[model samples]
Target: MKLAKRINSSSVFLVSGGARGVTSECVITLAQQYQCKFILLGRSPIIKIEPEYVKNYFDEYGLKKSIMEYQLSQAQKPTPISVQKIFNQISASREIKNTLSRLRQAGGSAEYFNIDVTDYVSLQAKVTHFSAITGIIHGAGNLADKLIEKKTEQDFEIVYAAKVQGLENLLSCVNIAQLQHIVLFSSTSGFYGNIGQTDYAMANEILNKSAHLIQQKYPNCHVVAINWGPWESGMVTPELKKAFTERNIGIIPVEVGTQMLVKELNSSKATPQVLVTSPVFPPATEFNLELKTYRIRRQLILDENPFLQDHIIAGKPVLPATCAMSWIINTCENIYSGYRLFSCKNFKVLKGIIFDETFVDEYILDIQEKAKDNNIQEVEVFARISSEKSQKVRYHFSGEFKFLREIPSAPLYTLPEEQKDTIPPWKDNNFYQNWVGMLFHGVSFQGMNKFITFSQEKFTAECFWQKIEAKQQGQFPVQWFNPYALDVSTHPLGIWLQHFYQKSALPASFERYEQFAPIPCNEDFYVTTEIKSESDFSTVADFVIFNSQGKVSARLFEVTFIRWFT
Candidate 1:
């Protein structure tokens, strides 16, 4: 996870659950950091009431005792239900004013609205006033603690309405296209399940699943559901607090809890549902979950697979690392249930698989779910190639997959300036095929459209889907990390050596490589390569694939290319 871009000052945030709870605390911190406007929502009513003051009338006789008596009498005075309601309203208004004051002092604006989140019509009517809401923090929920058998249907409805219905209503009513951040407050009860929190757990579980679905739909937005543990706040009764203390389950301090929230907001790779809790608690596996795995094999042939044929080195067809990743990813997709692969870490190509007429081989793929902690899962992936005669297996590709609950929002990247004015566009129609020595069929399928700039130290090329009739662009099985597109990204390396080295060269090995994010198939990319070092035997370089949004989809680091000589 990279450092997350901070919230813009122009953006407005909406926080539910009220002006004086955990949600409000998080909003106040965000307000201070970004100095953005906020609209706080709750179901409390507003009423005008002033602080009562006492006027001294008489008596230097027993002055201290008399004043104490007067105060005691005022405090003990009985009031009707109507008067009590007014007092409650006044207290709520004061709390809202205090919250607003704090935000204003920190150079941000804030407003409070009295509306129930479960009431869609009222929420919609109220939300229209804040048309520029760029983020939402939905933290409204109720707690009805009871054993499963003793729990009432009404109890379930009340708890579910706050989180499940509240989230549904917000998602249905809001302008999601404009939203950059969507944070849902979940709980450990929902994630691992507790004894007396059936409704609460169910509601929070809905939040976690909802975040996963929403993230898949909106990959560019930060959709997070934070599953928090118990905190030392108004919600915890004295008996409950004692029980927790006895069990050694530490209650989260308000300051610490808010800080964790801020940390989540600042991380670019935050998982969809982050379980912000202590390590001493019960493990998530207590709920009994099954791990997912995929196993598949494919036969490769040079005549049928033109991609391998095009990527030849020293008169022998060699499989590219990107294609290996494509095979693994595609296999995972065939058995995919709910999880989606987002980022690849520590990716490396160990050996090169050379293909010849006698190179009839089978490629095997396996992706297994390994470790499960909180809301994140670690998947181990492997792709191997072998033949019938020898038991020798070449493990061509290996990487760890971080399955995301919420997709990391697309980043705003700085594009490298194209030096097109100095370098003329390479306008040869069959440039990759004729000049670069790559086969025509392979180049077209890989979506190599045009060259932007090429030089010794730096190179930039453009890749787009071909508009030609009957030409299929990006036809590879693995569309998420488009190995064809990745191959296109490395086209400059091939062209640079072909133009300057006086000999055709193929990439034999890569020293190291990593992918920050998955490459999207639809967008046209500007592949930028920089020469880090060069010698007669080998050339090492780094390259980045920037999408149409000028954001890097994949970055290859310290790629050591051993020259292919025949």
Candidate 2:
């Protein structure tokens, strides 16, 4: 197969076992993330999404508004009548007119191919026509009682042949011009072997091991395996699904699983593999497991409202001032926006605040291109205004609310910190869109970071910023490196020594501390000074942060194992 000399927009991709469950999610994900031609491989070219299936998903997500937006009509479902309507439309002479019109308006490009992975000849022939493929996501599976029930003799043969044969066939195609990645779907059963699924277990074992084999053979191509655990899908019966995951949440909510899978796939780690999620989860940050050199006194974002000001100021400086809370917050906002729009199936966002080992380089690479294209030095996004004196930007579409880009009609108001006068977007409603602007105090940290003069300046914002960015010339901020993996309680002083230039902090700024108000406890404060276990942080530790004036700043926090109720 031939891929373009370089994999870019002209590349092609395949997702076998798409149109169902996690596989479909992969297809949707790659389609949006990469501009490439897509071929969806499934058992049948005709995706007969049944009404009952649609209804089942709607029932699962029982919110009325969600139901209205996501669920399809009975007519749209792949029922006999629905199928007949689709067929008629395809060949409509008014009789088959509907399908013709539908075909004309399918929006994006998609072609379906029916091929059984077990049928080796058919699989090879299917991919041969394409010169090369940039990527292949093998999410298809015969997860029938995957590990739940004993397998028949046939089950062993069928499961193994499908994944092994299909994968080997693709790899055997030596002439493939360029294949950057080959992602295999290995269930969690592979690692935590399943009792009942002897045959399916073998198939997963093959998938589980295939990544290593591919890496060995083709160093240029990244062979990634995703070990997915229990997920909500047709493969999972309701009772079994519940047993497989934590209570109160649906089986590994499809979106979370999908998001986790994509992140794992994009990672360049050696033989990169990721266990998508866990069955049980902890609620808060517990960072007593660290280098113990420091402790947080307090930490909080500057606020326009005085009450709000004191709200977050109860922790240590878990995040350095050099840390980009704005960037982190904006990343979450972008994630939220994508999920809200188009109900993009695979575009999943985790429900609550939890920081796991996330692969951020992939995300940066994807967004970096956009930033470069837009020449976006720094973008000041005004999300919410909590005060009247804060910057409130408005576009010229107030009269026509719900206008293009869904930009708001009125500026959100908030108090301006740094004490600048809040500028009104526009005093006149009839003003031009360009004329109506919001006050956003933004500075680009992308560059202009090399010269840091710390020899003699007061503790002004500029001085603080220069000290913060002393080491940030070629490198991104420490916060941007991997916020998820950060052990918060370790950085006790917020005194970044690498970036910490001359002692400008009143001669002995590091020499003193006095406890303000000690809350009488069961004498049960689980405290830690530093982290020694870098290897263990990923499996545990929600996050760890040093506090400022003892204010909380990180989602990853500091509580020992005992403080947790469970």
Candidate 3:
């Protein structure tokens, strides 16, 4: 609603991460509904998405194919920094032309600019070139694998440099003329450090600082940060993921997230600094084509490891036959908060951190109503440096929460390690040796030396299939799931096998517990949530944590009784 209103029947937009994830959703939404033209800039070449799927979407909804379809993947070419600098200008120019083309087709057109947002010079050029920049929604940045020992002088410099440059670029350019509005996607990862995401956290902080800069430099523009919980993007190394449990860093369902973003952006009546993310941002008019106001839900997993014995129900409790189901859900919510999320290693990166989910909503709302509000065209996430404010404390650990999913066609409970078997772990392809000792578990699981298939995301079926079909593909080697994480959930045991594909170095989706059912099983809990683009169903999960014991303890949920089908 806010977007529909903010974006007139015709507008022009530039989507940084246009080819994948949330950016893809923004592109599709802008194209389909508002008929906004876009300069969908991605490093990759034109993508060959099965347009049939998109066609089906329109047909299903009685919509039109106004969506200008194209494709882009991260264009890979490790050129010198100088050559990259030149490309930034050239790329920006090319993107502008493309964006303008899209706009003209949308009826009353505009321009688009493509630059390596990770590159500063290009960003400045792009910004200065666009005068009617109404709103900016930034969603571009790199997620570095968190490795303390691996941290090098060059890596550190590269990390902060991009962040510094991007902001400088935006600030310098926006000031060239009056700006309208902006949205920055910060992550919970920056709030805390997960096992292998030191760089990621650092980069995320840069996003926050950029928001501050926008407020400071572009005072007239409505600038805000959408501190996201996590989505399947950015950086996460598989081996490093095993030690964390919160998994909130990149666990947002793309569809729901996009909708929330649309709603928040649309509800210009209110402006917020940050929002934890929920269905209801009720301070303004609610124009949802979907149902219900909002809710957050969780399933309590009871552990029998005696390690969780203390979390058991306090008293003898009632007999299994006459137990109240409501009590079970209520108990489960508490248990989930305490044990699973608060202390879960997967999400330790976000522990002990503070953020204002409400702030984001409120801030956006305030900005919408203020006289300073202007039309925003695009937003960007840039690289940044670590601030020296809280340096001394080595934050190896923190706190968290968990939200578990119910298996559809709900079945009986199984043991924690009881998952089906899958392909065993393979040797680390690159000589990095971090995963060297990991084959031990793989040998146990698959009984042989397994061949690797991938390492750092970016491979897709069309890309990898050709590799598999190649005889000389030996030199074009691939690593199987990282010893750290894997998506092989079909195996009785949900193994953490991970290989990069589509998103990043991490397995885009962790195949936890066979399969996951969509949220809202017991409708009384979650109001519901999916769609921005093909990336609509993409997901990452956040666990709300609570502590019940010395270890990461959550209240374990149990089903004491159920109603008869009669």
Candidate 4:
């Protein structure tokens, strides 16, 4: 388990609802690990002395009976509600004292405040004095388990006020600039609505959204709303636990739940909201539907796609063939949830988009479902793009998409033995300067770092994986397939054509392409191109892209490039 390096003994943490239950368990873990100072807040007041009758009773049933007997001896009527009230007060005080003692034993100091967090004036007055606080864990929340129709207005207020209004009051008093971390304890009910937790779900969802908004304003602060699933402790009663077990919903252990919070704080990747649920949750099942053709209209302009300016051919911007393939995969993935593109077959560019003249009408992407197998969790779809020109449809590109339930594992790749007669490798700058003159790709697409091996039949090169900004990726941003990396991997083939045939070439079509994993950006990877066949008009080849570990990430089979003669 990785620990957060940023947290130390001197760090001061402010936690709400931290004197008892699951929150107290987490507080103890933090104290044991970091030995930090904590300010714990709760609504229960400390009990210095226990009543004589309740002192001897530990269990709830015994305590209730003892309280009722004491009330009878006092010549008073013992109502059920009055007996339950005294029992609750005794239980809360003992829990709070046990938590405080554990914190001290774990080598941490703590200060407890008995105040309702929903009371803004009192909360603000107490919080304003804490100038040295470094982090905040907003874990205060109440649950009223009643259906919407049966619930009263007071029930909703009690649940919502602790989470929503409490957070507002805390933030209003704290110094935002002095804080380094803000963790909101949201719930899975907020993410996936639950039947009897309407008020709870609404309050938690507000916390999730607030985390995003706060992160945008304070970019340096680590803000995250963890939508945790049901846990083994806290509000889950025995009856509720049995119900969850019958439904096959897994319960997170107290130790595992606290450790996950530490891991989340240590992660370098910043995500504003995340759902942390156990693996026992049910898998997604396919929805039955009738086969239908869906058409999406889109208009491409040179001003919108600035990266196309780098892909100039004959003084005109031309869309790379890789971008067209990305459109097909992204569209299909968006249509269905819990499905990913497994492979694309028979991808052909009949008439590529060239900005020789501005178009006045929108282009249409037509997708039709060909087949679906729910048991296998696979769907086959055919996609095509066309535009109406003078009342006639001019087809641009077409392909077949296969979406599967899971992404396949990356295949192993071994570098082929080099030929003895092959020339020494060319440095990146020297080869790219000559290659770009023929291919006309700009800096954004120029990813070749070094040419390692070259021969008549095969060649290998190391290419830098450049990161594309969201703004520069155009309307069809890189999702499943990165257009820039794919385009750059084909550079060796372009160099081969220029070296032997003295002509530039463009990708015409490919028989099949498979993506096992996403290509990592801002790193270097190896590209190996093997020439299958060559002709005067076109060249057919296979390309394998892999990392330094020799794990094949993607492969293009029987890719045909049409030679250009000008």
Best by TM-score: 4
Relative to the true structure, candidate 1 has a C-alpha RMSD (angstroms) of: 13.1
TM-score of each: 0.46, 0.41, 0.37, 0.77
Q: Which ten residues in a row have the lowest lDDT in candidate 4?
A: 278-287
Better of 2 and 3 by lDDT: 2
lDDT values, one for every candidate: 0.68, 0.38, 0.34, 0.83
Clashing residue pair totals per candidate (backbone < 3 A): 1, 60, 101, 0
Write model 2 residue lDDT over 232-275, tens digit each, in one string: 65356665554454322235777777677656655545455556
lDDT of 1 by residue, 1-566 (tens): 22224686887878888587677777778877888988888887544444343124223334334444555676854334544454455556666777778888878888888888999999899887677888889989998888889989999999999999999888777888778889999987787676678899999999999998877777777889998888877366666566465444678998889889888888878578898766333322221246666556667655566555556665786777777766666665444423345655566666656776545457666666665444453333433433343666556567665543334665555655666674645567465556645322354345655666767888777777433222222224544556766766666676677677754444544544445455655567777788999889878788877787777777776676666552
lDDT of 2 at 305: 15
The TM-score measured for candidate 4 stands at 0.77
- List runs of model 1 lying over 4 Å from the truth: 1-5, 51-90, 280-566
Return model 4's CA RMSD, one decimal: 5.7
- When 1 and 2 are scored with TM-score, the better candidate is 1
